[model samples]
Target: MPPPILVTGGTGTLGRHVVARLHDAGRDVRVLTRHARPGESGIEFISGDLLSGRGVDAAVAGVETIVHCASSFKGDPEAARNLVRAALRAGRPHLVYISIVGVDRIPMASPIGRTMFGYLASKLATERVVAESGLPWTTLRSTQFHDLILMVARKLARLPVVPAPAGFRFHPVDADDVAARLVEITLRTPAGRVPDIGGPRVYGAADLLRGYLGAARRRRPVVPVPVPGKGARAFHAGANLAPDHAVSGRTWEEFLADQVGDAPAGG
Candidate 1:
């Protein structure tokens, strides 16, 4: 039998869906996670921390395709470095990385930049690691996921007044949509920096939050607040949008309706 495909962060918001697609396609999948998990049919869970080098070599052993979906608010480049080092020792494998769209466009250089936009810098560094890893690689940069937007909306809704960052907009796509694309990339020859994937529509911060609140049967006033810094300033110029590549199905309203409750897709 051929070796299984390895998916880092196979249990995360995006990684789990990638694992599911591979499993459904009759491909054996190995998941590398920081925490211990039980293996299911055709899907084996390997306990390995990407932040450290532990268990990573074993995780990469005999795998031809590695879908790198694991990420954090910080330390993403470190994790990618660890994975790259191990992959080099193991063998040449197809490394497919998932990154956000504005990692390159945003400037994460100052105090506010590091505080609010540091994650973009980390991801860009990770992308570099993958590209220069001496292995065949494919990278996909997507807009914010529906799950992420949903979480933010839920948190801000807890407050009596939700502070919507002015001039910020999102093209939130479904995690499953991204996972499907990852699976396609995994099964195909390595394509460097594929065209971005974004949601069907773009929604402003206030509109997005209002949609979620309406879906959840909650009412909260969304007030616009000026976001500070050059990074945010760059983002306000639509660094986070991908109108040309808005090929993914599943709108924000659709996801919110499903997550919160029955409501109209339009808010």
Candidate 2:
């Protein structure tokens, strides 16, 4: 019998897609999660916590590849540390990590790095741990997800007038597009830091909100809000874009049409 392909955060936005693809391809899957879950056709949910190192070693046992997709707003670096330690003890399966683009260039170099770009710092710190860990590793840096942008737009639209960050732009990619690429990578030998992937087009934050409002069949005035700090400057300058490496993905306009075309009025 073949060993199961382990996926962290297998229930999350991106991890679920990875799990589905792997399962469809006839690969048995093991998911490390905080809650207990019933096993599926070819999927087994293993109880583990990456942040505290509890049950992580058992999850890593007998695995040949690990698609690490679990992440939090905080403690990402610590979680990676725990996973690395366990993988080493279990003979070091190929570690595939999903990270965000521009983490290295986001300029999180201060005592207050965690204030504005805390998530960026967390991802960067985790990247360092993965790179330095002595295990055979592959890291894929990707742009923001379309689902994330939609969530932000929905929140901003709740206000009578949305405050758009001045000069903020993102090249958002579809999560499934990223997941497909990731599964392809996972099926192969480790490649260190493959090319970055992004959406089909770049859209300003306000433009994205406008797209959402249009799809949701609501109207709201958008006002530009000035932002400070080098971190903000980086985002303003398209630090999150990957034009040269854009994936053939679902466009923002298309995603809005699918997800928001049926939203409640003013939702």
Candidate 3:
């Protein structure tokens, strides 16, 4: 049998899918989590915390590869550095880190950019950690997930009129598609900083809001409000898009369809 693979954030949105895929493919898989449930067949769960470096070494012990899907908006850089240290001490396993697109392109002055600056900055720091760790590593940058987009939009749809951020665009890829790509990457040798993975199509904020309203059977008007900031400008300039690497097949509409169980209420 091949060496076991360690998966951090195994219970997370994307990590769970990767774990499922690896398990289905009959690979020996171990997951690191803060809480490990008992009697879980076919998966070895280790109690660990990446942010504090607890049990990380134990999690990496005898593992050949690590699919790092865990991240925090507040403590990403520290968490990543800790993970890198643990992995290095454990013979430098192949590390796969998931990142967001436009981490380098989005200016910090924009509203959206300002709000995400801390998270993006931390991710950048984490990327640097992996790159300079002298370890074989692959980092994949993916666009926003469809579920995230809908979650925000759905919340906004609760108002009488949904307000869309002006000049903002999104390329919302399905989480499952991103997970599959991560799994594929993990199965192969590490490829450093590959091209980004984007959704099948791009949609403006208003269109996304309208889609949410339609799905929830809400007749709220999607008002395009001027969210003028450096962030909005950056997004308008296509900082959020991966025009060269739109590889995913699932569209936001299809995701919405799945949630609604048919076509949206009106269309």
Candidate 2 lDDT score at position 153: 86
**TM-score of every candidate relative to the true structure:** 0.97, 0.95, 0.94
The digit string of per-residue lDDT tens for model 3 on 166-212 reads 87898889888888889899999999998899999888888888887
* Model 2 lDDT tens row, 1-267: 779999999999999999999998889999999998899889999998999888899899999999999999889999999999999999989999999999977777664545888898889889899999999999999999999998888889999999999999989999999999999999999988999899888878888778788888888998999877888888888887898999877888778778878533332
- Model 2 is weakest, by summed lDDT over 10 consecutive residues, at 258-267
RMSD of 2: 2.6
Pairs that collide in candidate 1 are none
Higher-TM-score candidate of 1 and 2: 1
Alpha carbon lDDT at 179, candidate 3 = 85
Number of the predicted model whose TM-score against the real structure is largest = 1
lDDT of 1 by residue, 1-267 (tens): 778999999999999899999999989999998889789999999998988788999999999999999888778888998999899888989999999998899988789888898778888999999999999999999999999999988899999999999999888999999899889989999999999999899989889988988889887888999999999888799998889998648888778777889766576
Best by lDDT: 1
- Looking at model 2, residue 239 earns an lDDT score of 85
Candidate 3 wrongly placed segments (more than 4 Å)? 109-113, 265-267
